[model samples]
Target: MRLSAEHAHLIRAQALELAGAQARVRLYGSRLHDHLRGGDVDLLLELPSLPANPALLAAQLAGRVSRALHGRKVDVLIDAPGLKQLPIHQIARSQGVLL
Candidate 1:
Protein backbone atom coordinates (compact mmCIF):
# COMPACT_ATOMS: atom_id res chain seq x y z
CA MET A 1 0.00 0.00 0.00
CA ARG A 2 1.20 3.49 -0.86
CA LEU A 3 0.76 6.10 1.87
CA SER A 4 0.58 9.84 1.56
CA ALA A 5 2.84 12.05 3.65
CA GLU A 6 0.13 13.07 6.10
CA HIS A 7 -1.38 9.62 6.53
CA ALA A 8 2.01 8.03 6.81
CA HIS A 9 3.08 10.47 9.49
CA LEU A 10 -0.11 10.04 11.49
CA ILE A 11 0.06 6.27 11.29
CA ARG A 12 3.67 6.20 12.40
CA ALA A 13 3.09 8.53 15.32
CA GLN A 14 0.02 6.70 16.57
CA ALA A 15 1.60 3.30 16.09
CA LEU A 16 4.63 4.23 18.12
CA GLU A 17 2.53 5.78 20.85
CA LEU A 18 0.23 2.78 21.09
CA ALA A 19 2.87 0.08 20.84
CA GLY A 20 5.70 1.87 22.56
CA ALA A 21 8.88 -0.24 22.32
CA GLN A 22 7.38 -3.70 22.19
CA ALA A 23 5.08 -3.82 19.22
CA ARG A 24 5.34 -3.31 15.48
CA VAL A 25 2.59 -1.52 13.54
CA ARG A 26 1.69 -2.08 9.89
CA LEU A 27 -0.81 -0.17 7.71
CA TYR A 28 -2.72 -1.98 4.97
CA GLY A 29 -5.70 -1.73 2.51
CA SER A 30 -7.18 1.01 0.32
CA ARG A 31 -6.73 3.77 2.87
CA LEU A 32 -3.08 3.70 1.94
CA HIS A 33 -3.89 5.35 -1.36
CA ASP A 34 -4.08 9.08 -2.09
CA HIS A 35 -7.56 9.48 -3.56
CA LEU A 36 -9.33 7.14 -1.20
CA ARG A 37 -12.76 7.28 0.46
CA GLY A 38 -11.64 7.45 4.04
CA GLY A 39 -12.06 3.73 4.51
CA ASP A 40 -11.20 2.42 7.95
CA VAL A 41 -7.41 2.55 8.43
CA ASP A 42 -6.28 -1.03 8.55
CA LEU A 43 -3.53 -1.52 11.14
CA LEU A 44 -1.69 -4.62 12.19
CA LEU A 45 0.10 -4.19 15.48
CA GLU A 46 2.29 -6.99 16.68
CA LEU A 47 2.91 -7.03 20.39
CA PRO A 48 5.08 -9.26 22.47
CA SER A 49 2.26 -9.98 24.87
CA LEU A 50 -1.35 -9.05 25.42
CA PRO A 51 -2.07 -6.28 27.83
CA ALA A 52 -3.98 -6.77 31.09
CA ASN A 53 -6.99 -4.91 29.69
CA PRO A 54 -7.14 -5.32 25.94
CA ALA A 55 -10.51 -3.62 25.48
CA LEU A 56 -9.43 -0.51 27.33
CA LEU A 57 -6.30 -0.22 25.24
CA ALA A 58 -8.26 -0.66 22.04
CA ALA A 59 -10.77 2.01 23.02
CA GLN A 60 -8.12 4.42 24.14
CA LEU A 61 -6.08 3.94 20.99
CA ALA A 62 -9.15 4.34 18.81
CA GLY A 63 -10.18 7.54 20.52
CA ARG A 64 -6.76 9.08 20.33
CA VAL A 65 -6.28 8.01 16.73
CA SER A 66 -9.67 9.22 15.62
CA ARG A 67 -9.08 12.60 17.18
CA ALA A 68 -5.64 12.83 15.66
CA LEU A 69 -6.84 11.97 12.17
CA HIS A 70 -9.97 14.10 12.32
CA GLY A 71 -12.79 12.63 10.14
CA ARG A 72 -10.84 9.58 9.06
CA LYS A 73 -11.79 6.20 10.50
CA VAL A 74 -9.13 4.15 12.27
CA ASP A 75 -9.13 0.40 12.58
CA VAL A 76 -6.45 -1.02 14.80
CA LEU A 77 -5.38 -4.64 14.74
CA ILE A 78 -3.33 -5.69 17.75
CA ASP A 79 -1.27 -8.78 17.18
CA ALA A 80 0.66 -11.07 19.47
CA PRO A 81 2.47 -14.38 19.37
CA GLY A 82 -0.44 -16.15 21.01
CA LEU A 83 -2.66 -15.82 17.96
CA LYS A 84 -0.64 -18.26 15.81
CA GLN A 85 -3.65 -20.54 15.50
CA LEU A 86 -5.55 -18.03 13.39
CA PRO A 87 -4.84 -17.92 9.66
CA ILE A 88 -5.13 -14.14 9.23
CA HIS A 89 -2.68 -13.74 12.03
CA GLN A 90 -0.04 -14.60 9.47
CA ILE A 91 -0.23 -11.03 8.17
CA ALA A 92 0.78 -9.70 11.54
CA ARG A 93 3.60 -12.15 11.74
CA SER A 94 5.05 -12.07 8.26
CA GLN A 95 3.80 -9.01 6.34
CA GLY A 96 4.06 -6.39 9.07
CA VAL A 97 6.16 -3.34 8.28
CA LEU A 98 7.30 -2.00 11.63
CA LEU A 99 6.34 1.55 12.46
Candidate 2:
Protein backbone atom coordinates (compact mmCIF):
# COMPACT_ATOMS: atom_id res chain seq x y z
CA MET A 1 0.00 0.00 0.00
CA ARG A 2 1.06 3.59 -0.59
CA LEU A 3 2.04 4.86 2.82
CA SER A 4 0.59 8.26 3.48
CA ALA A 5 2.79 11.19 4.46
CA GLU A 6 1.21 11.13 7.90
CA HIS A 7 2.19 7.50 8.34
CA ALA A 8 5.69 8.28 7.16
CA HIS A 9 5.92 11.14 9.61
CA LEU A 10 4.86 8.87 12.44
CA ILE A 11 7.40 6.27 11.42
CA ARG A 12 10.20 8.83 11.29
CA ALA A 13 9.34 10.25 14.65
CA GLN A 14 9.10 6.87 16.34
CA ALA A 15 12.31 5.71 14.69
CA LEU A 16 14.20 8.76 15.94
CA GLU A 17 12.88 8.18 19.41
CA LEU A 18 13.93 4.53 19.37
CA ALA A 19 17.33 5.38 17.93
CA GLY A 20 18.00 7.69 20.83
CA ALA A 21 18.08 4.74 23.22
CA GLN A 22 19.80 2.25 20.94
CA ALA A 23 22.95 2.53 18.88
CA ARG A 24 21.50 3.29 15.47
CA VAL A 25 18.22 2.73 13.67
CA ARG A 26 18.33 2.69 9.88
CA LEU A 27 15.31 2.75 7.60
CA TYR A 28 15.77 0.23 4.84
CA GLY A 29 13.79 -1.66 2.15
CA SER A 30 10.98 -0.33 -0.01
CA ARG A 31 9.49 1.75 2.81
CA LEU A 32 12.33 4.17 2.32
CA HIS A 33 11.37 4.77 -1.27
CA ASP A 34 8.93 7.55 -2.05
CA HIS A 35 6.76 5.22 -4.10
CA LEU A 36 6.63 1.60 -3.09
CA ARG A 37 4.31 -0.94 -1.54
CA GLY A 38 3.91 -4.50 -0.23
CA GLY A 39 6.90 -4.04 2.03
CA ASP A 40 7.21 -3.90 5.77
CA VAL A 41 8.90 -1.06 7.63
CA ASP A 42 12.40 -2.48 7.55
CA LEU A 43 14.52 -1.33 10.47
CA LEU A 44 18.08 -2.24 11.19
CA LEU A 45 18.62 -1.46 14.84
CA GLU A 46 22.08 -1.61 16.32
CA LEU A 47 22.77 -1.69 20.01
CA PRO A 48 26.26 -0.55 20.86
CA SER A 49 26.20 -1.45 24.53
CA LEU A 50 25.52 -5.02 25.45
CA PRO A 51 22.94 -4.85 28.13
CA ALA A 52 22.21 -7.63 30.62
CA ASN A 53 19.18 -8.61 28.56
CA PRO A 54 19.70 -7.50 24.99
CA ALA A 55 16.63 -9.23 23.65
CA LEU A 56 14.48 -7.60 26.27
CA LEU A 57 15.57 -4.13 25.26
CA ALA A 58 14.97 -4.83 21.61
CA ALA A 59 11.60 -6.35 22.33
CA GLN A 60 10.58 -3.41 24.49
CA LEU A 61 11.46 -0.92 21.81
CA ALA A 62 9.62 -2.86 19.16
CA GLY A 63 6.63 -3.32 21.37
CA ARG A 64 6.48 0.37 22.20
CA VAL A 65 6.60 1.35 18.57
CA SER A 66 4.03 -1.24 17.55
CA ARG A 67 1.69 -0.29 20.35
CA ALA A 68 2.07 3.43 19.88
CA LEU A 69 1.08 3.16 16.27
CA HIS A 70 -1.80 0.77 16.04
CA GLY A 71 -2.24 -1.15 12.77
CA ARG A 72 1.24 -0.15 11.60
CA LYS A 73 3.45 -3.04 10.58
CA VAL A 74 7.18 -3.01 11.32
CA ASP A 75 9.99 -5.51 11.23
CA VAL A 76 12.89 -4.73 13.53
CA LEU A 77 16.32 -6.29 13.22
CA ILE A 78 18.68 -5.75 16.10
CA ASP A 79 22.36 -6.01 15.31
CA ALA A 80 24.65 -6.12 18.29
CA PRO A 81 28.23 -5.01 17.87
CA GLY A 82 30.94 -7.70 17.57
CA LEU A 83 28.43 -10.40 16.77
CA LYS A 84 27.24 -12.20 13.64
CA GLN A 85 29.54 -12.31 10.61
CA LEU A 86 27.19 -12.39 7.66
CA PRO A 87 28.33 -10.20 4.75
CA ILE A 88 24.88 -8.78 4.06
CA HIS A 89 24.50 -7.88 7.72
CA GLN A 90 27.93 -6.33 7.70
CA ILE A 91 27.06 -4.31 4.60
CA ALA A 92 23.90 -3.16 6.29
CA ARG A 93 25.99 -2.17 9.26
CA SER A 94 28.38 -0.13 7.17
CA GLN A 95 26.33 1.19 4.25
CA GLY A 96 22.85 1.26 5.68
CA VAL A 97 20.96 4.55 5.81
CA LEU A 98 20.62 5.87 9.35
CA LEU A 99 17.29 7.31 10.36
lDDT of all predictions: 0.66, 0.63
The TM-score of candidate 2 is: 0.63
RMSD of each: 2.9, 3.6
Model 2: CA > 4 A from native: 1-22
How far does residue 91 in candidate 2 sit from its true spot (Å)? 4.5
**Model 1 accuracy (lDDT, Cα):** 0.66
Q: What lDDT score is found at residue 88 in candidate 1?
A: 56
Tens digits of lDDT, candidate 1, 30-51:
6556677657766776678876
Name the runs in model 1 displaced over 4 angstroms.
33-36, 83-85, 92-97
Candidate 2 has an lDDT of 0.63
Best by TM-score: 1
